[model samples]
Target: MAHATSIQYEPVAEIGGGAYGTVYKARDTESGQFVALKSVRVQTDQNGLPISTVREVALLKRMEQFDHPNVVRLMDVCATTRSDQETKVTLVFEHVDQDLKTYLEKTPSPGLSPERIKDLMRQLLCGLAFLHSNRVMHRDLKPENILVTSQGQVKLADFGLAKIHSCHMALTPVVVTLWYRPPEVLLQSSYATPVDIWSTGCIFAEMFRRKPLFCGESEVDQLGKIFEVIGLPPEEEWPTDVTLSRTNFPPLMPRPIADFVPEINEQGAQLLMKMLTFDPLKRISALNALEHSYFQDEETLTQKKS
Candidate 1:
């Protein structure tokens, strides 16, 4: 922790690590603000840095304009200059209280009550709506990427795999981790914003149950878990020419959601099922989900029942 010509980075304890970078909680003296500095480890083949990191940095830089309550803020980008080696670029972001994984782990089972679940889901939907409105697809949406602030607000992070619907790149099925991946992605179809809705559904179930709704080890297993809770994918649900790498089409009837989590209410089950729909076209959009009875307030519920 040293202060130099207007730019001082105070390195705090390590927050987390990723494939190419190690994230540390830090303070930027220039702005007198706390930020998460993700330092990309420099490798040698006589090459500078990975192209993927460059892409992430560039995208995140542009995405800074997306200042929303539910979206993680990228503060600044700086370089670390050492004694005698190649310099490294560090991406700075807003410091979050904790990731949803650690948050869930620390909390007791039946941790988040129904009201809290609705609040979290509402915040998630708000974030997703903002991202979709900006045409940004968060390919990876899971507990690990959803962070909770000390103020109890949830914000979406980890834009390394995010794809901004811009003129710069082509849309490919660059699917994220198997767990949060949508059914359309599992079927090898070029995915869109609906994929995030699918992940949000999974996260919503997870927050309510305090565990992964679908803890599948592989793609087939993942699809199996999804099907188990939400039912199988009909052949007509998929596009004719779409290709699947692992699982076969004409899926068998899946097990019931009640069998897995009997405590979930009928409204919750219906909402989850719609989000997990095999057909992207049929999947619930985040905006529409926010309007659903699933997120209804006490007043709204009374009105609906009456």
Candidate 2:
């Protein structure tokens, strides 16, 4: 395989695009390896790279130090010039079969099995553990950020909102997509890695059912959906820094996990409850979560593979 230092790749096709960049499926000319290249436009206004793009580049550079099957691999990064006078910075990542959202939409099978969901949850937890161990918070952890490889392996990707713990001092809660965003974040609490865990729980539910567990239209509505499932957090459970701490949120008791998603097994429900705990300190960390009973079989599979 050609290292990042080598310039050898052939464009395959455009996979997706967003405001900051366009993702292209490409093949390494030297090794014939397929990879996804995210090309971000170079913006300069007498300053360096855009703050968002720079943050992503820096995070990817740091993540490169560690390698895990469940974490997307950064193959390379290089600058390319376009005839239109735009210099684009391209991020090279290992090719994934498709994003989880797309894969779920295309899967012909019925809903995912309990075992398959467990396997994916374990992989996601492993990837989250890697990120949290390095003191990085993947703020935007949703189904779209979860990619499925051609071999059916699940990898965590899309770190545009990710933040290194010390880079910005304490974490700012101004991140995460609304659907998967933790309630603490919505309430503007001082967030930590637990926020990512909360989002992971939401993704786990979505993967199993092929629909968002809490599909709220607005922030208020979103909180309502969460409260509907997990029950209202007691006043004592609210963090000191959480916004509207003094404001009275209704006292809606949490419903049984089985009531909403009966398809989820008891173990899965337990894991989700741990992740969605109102108290961040009480919430299960990814490191501890990897040892949960839901992943006992996954541990065996991992050992067999090793």
TM-score of each: 0.79, 0.80
TM-score of 2: 0.80
For residues 1-306, write the lDDT of model 1, one tens digit per residue: 113512576876787654334678877777777788776443322455456556666766776776788989987776555423445666678888688888888888658777777788889889889878766778778898799987779999865443322211243233346888887777677778898999988887777677788777777778777776666666566567665633553356766766765667787888888887878888989899888876665558679999
**Quick one: RMSD of model 2?**
5.4
Candidate 1 residue pairs that clash: none
Local distance difference test scores for all models: 0.72, 0.76
Clashes of each: 0, 1
List candidate 1 stretches off by more than 4 Å: 1-7, 30-32, 39-63, 79-89, 160-176, 245-251, 301-306
Query: What is the model-wide C-alpha lDDT for candidate 1?
Result: 0.72
